[model samples]
Target: MSATDWIHSFDRFDGRKGIKPGLERMEAMLLLLGQPHRDLRFVHVAGTNGKGSTCAFLASVLEQAGYRVGLYTSPYLSAFGDRMRIGGCNITDDALDALVDRVKPVVEEVAATVHGRPTEFEVITLLSILFYAQERVDFVVWETGLGGRLDATNVVTPLLSLITNVGRDHEAILGQGIERIAVEKAGIIKPGVPVLTTAKGVALDVIERTAREQGAPCYAADRDFSAKRTAYGLDGQSFDWRGIGDHHVALRIRLLGPHQIDNAALALAACVQLRRMGVAITGEAMQAGLKSAAWPGRLEIVSQSPLTLLDGAHNPEGAAALAAALKELLPNRRLIFVIGILADKAIPDVLAPLTELAAHVIVTRPDMDRAAQTSDVADAVRTLAPTTPVETMDRVSSALYRATVLAMEQRGAVICTGSLYMISEARAVLVP
Candidate 1:
């Protein structure tokens, strides 16, 4: 089978339309493939929102320092091969096809075990590890596909572990509380491997206790390190990183938002820790890396005429962060918003904060298996923001077009948000 076809074939093993968290199948796959992760250094990252951005920042810094960094992030913003990258480039199709050809039989073998069939994520994790090993990358910054304890990527012990922050997300599978989610994410902490986190309050308590129990050094944000925003705008932001090392005067990032300052600080703290671990990184590289790092679909600006922005704010914490950023950045401006959401999220909670900022909203559904209906999303918006005008559109392209036109007429900004899948759909229409 063609590699693209093989990747698409994973839909058949969707596992109850969700994640089946465990390491048995992953372990069996590793044993059969001869443990490709051995001799490879890793920087495993886990969190509710900032995992991808943090990975991007860390990878870019390492790359700037001249290390061939391998980054593995989930739920690709564009294409399937976007999941695995070395030096910020996606694996070529020929490379992916060859790797899949070698692993397909092993995947089938793992499928027959008492551990049962490996899910798509499990196989993808295996493939990423193999690709990284074969390519001889300097370091792999691995992001968990789900909660960390049983995530396939968690099988590798890392040079360090980072939890960007914890909040209520994937509650059905990760359990209900923020602390529960924090515990699951902190599972990536290995014995004696230092841990850094931006989590606060109860989640901070959980992360600290877990790291203490694991005999890992914990660098908690606000306790060990803190960042103060120097300046911020739609283009980018600058912050002063102060903690866990010498103070950085002004670390600039293109990611956007105050929450991103925390993400960048977490990444900077990691760079300091990596330097202590014998990795050769310079101050110039850190500055340049933070300045140049780009993560698609997180407050990504795709257009300038009506000042359109796209963010993957699908959950409560994420939506709150986006809302807070817009409130801080735009103040009195009520934006025209085009939003699409997944069927299984806490719909009202996700819509509440964002709808508060909307002058007009067009609800739509992304082309994904579990996308919530546009009518359902519009109903949620109406309930949340009684004064805001809401409309339903089945197609993201149409929704974006309408939002843009209304934004221009009203002399307001446009925000395309809801989820990463939603932003991907909007990108196809808006970016080109």
Candidate 2:
């Protein structure tokens, strides 16, 4: 099938969506594809936020150590192919087209046999596994798309499972409270496998209990491992890792925010655990990888003209982190905010911290089915920042353009945030 044809197939599949949780369909699909997931080793990552960053860090570190690495992440910042990377490069169009073609027939057969039409995410998950196996990846770092237990990517039995922090996002699907959400995220823990996590609060307790119940050795941050910030600047963050004993190293990451330092620590700890499991990673390689790793769209400064920043702060915790980073990085400058949020997210919680920093706010909806309308988001922003001027634009591009124009007029920086969907849309329009 052609690239357009595959895209059309996915568009068609997306129309039949429902939120049923199970690995049965994915299991069947992978089994039909000769269980590609089993042929490769993986470090499965799950959490409400920071999973992509953690996965990118792990992939970069493993690659720097001279291993062929495959990284599969979701909700790409720029392109569809960004979801599947081998040796730090996005999958080529020809390879993606071929994999889609190979999977189409089986998907059709499954649909006809069991009335099981796989969702767009499920198809992408299968393609990632096939591509990883075909490329003979030494290790594949997989990030769960949503709640972990029944996610399509959970079909793999990982070398080490890492949960990056859990918060009150996706409440409807995961559950109402932190403990319930942690249990769902903890679903990725497999028997006898080692799990590493940065989960805190009641969520941390739940994950620890789950790991213990599954007979998995658990390494919780601040206990088994930790990252302490030595210093942070607009350049990057510097932190020290304490898990590898004599292998302790002071590291700097290109990614911004103090939270990123914690993410770096999580990745380093996971790498050390993998090495202990007999993976051929050295201390020198870990240092190089930590320094070189870059995950875009988390506090990413896409342009200096009017000083535009883009962040995928879709949840309360992520938004708070972004707000703190903004306060530290651009202190005393009143920020012009371009905001977009999803229908399913906790808008009040996410926008609370962000509203305090805004000199003016422009609300827009991304071109996505799940996007919250601009007017509704604007109304919410009004409640948070009553004195801050708020306007609504139907298109993200128009909102971004207007924000740049306004910020330039006022000699202020523009912050575009609220959802990954918006950041992806804004990056497409603003960067190019």
Candidate 3:
């Protein structure tokens, strides 16, 4: 089959809706493929949020340390090839086509079995493992597509596991409570593996207990390692970090927001453990990686005039972070928010924080089957802030345009948020 055909075929799984959250299908596929994931060393990351940023930091640091690093993150920001990368380069179309051709029969065979069809995520996971193995990558930074315990990426026993602070997203499949969600995230903690986390309170307790039960060494973020923000602005933040080897003073990161400093601390702590495992990650490499690591669609400033910022804050905690960042960076300025979210998210909770921060809101739906209806978002805004002006548009690009116009008129700033997929479309408009 052609590369385009293979890419389009994955839509059959209906994205996250077809998520099975079990290892049987993944295990069977890996077994038939002769266990390609077995040959690769990995750092597996899981959480409701910040997991992608943590993986970005880890992969960049390992690459700077002169190792061939393969990165596997789900729900690509832009392109299909973005899901899998080796040494900072995405897997080529030719290579992907070839890999799909090889695995097509095996996937069909497995589909014919009692397990039925493997989800799109499972196929992508298998493709990533096979590609990384064939390329002989020194390390793979694997980000779970969904919850940790039963995620397809969790099939591998990684050198280190990271839970980048669990929050209450994906309540339907993973569970509604923080403790239950924490349990799902902590499931990646394998026996004897060193797992690091920044989760606090009851979630932290759940993760700590899981680590203890699994006989894994647990490194808590605040207790074991921490970052104190020394300086920050639109450019980024400089932080002093402690508990991860020699304290780095004023480590600069351009990721934006105070929350990112926490993610960076988790990454730095992971590197410390990697060093203990004889990975040869030096201080200079860590410094360089921290400065250069890039994760788009999180407080990303796309335009200087009117100051258009794009963040994928689709949940309550994420929205709170975005609000805090806006307040810290541009205090006393009115905010024009352009937002869209998936149907599965806590819609009202996600929009509530922004209501207090925004001068007005433009609601639109992303080009996805699971996107929340634009009218629903408008209704939520009315409930939260009855006086706030609300605009509804059928298209994401149109909604962004309206917000930018309003921001320019008010001499304020614009924030396009709520869904990562929608921000991808929004970014194309602003950045392109």
lDDT against the true structure, each candidate: 0.89, 0.87, 0.89
Worst 10 residues of 3 by lDDT: 10-19
Q: Pick the winner on lDDT between candidates 1 and 2.
A: 1
TM-score of 1: 0.97
Candidate 2 displacement at residue 269 in angstroms: 0.1
Off by over 4 Å in 1: 11-18
* Per-residue accuracy of model 2 over 1-432 as CA lDDT, tens digit each: 566456546532243444656787788887787887888998999998899999989999999999999999988888888999998789999999888889888888776666377777888888889999999999999999998998888999999999999999877777798888999899999999999999898988988899999999999888888888888877888888898464567888889998888788999999899888888898889989988998889888888887888899999999999998998899988699999999878998999999999999999988888899888888899998889999999888998889989999999999999888889888888777
Rank ordering of all candidates by TM-score, starting from the highest: 1, 3, 2
lDDT of 3 by residue, 338-378 (tens): 98999878999999889898898999989988899988889
Candidate 1: tens digits of C-alpha lDDT, residues 1-432: 788677667633355656666898888888888988986999999999999999999999999999999999988877887889999899999999999999999989877878777777887888889999999999999999888998888899999999988989889888889988888998999999999999989988998899999999999888788899989988899888887555655788998898899899999999989998889999999999999999999988998888899999989999999999999888877699998999989989999888888899999999877899888888888888888898999989998889889988988899998979989888878876
Top TM-score hit: 1
lDDT, candidate 3, residue 243? 77
Model 3's alpha-carbon lDDT is 0.89
Candidate 3 Cα outliers beyond 4 Å, as residue runs: 7-18, 244-249
Candidate 3 to truth, TM: 0.97
Model 2: clashing residue pairs? Answer: none
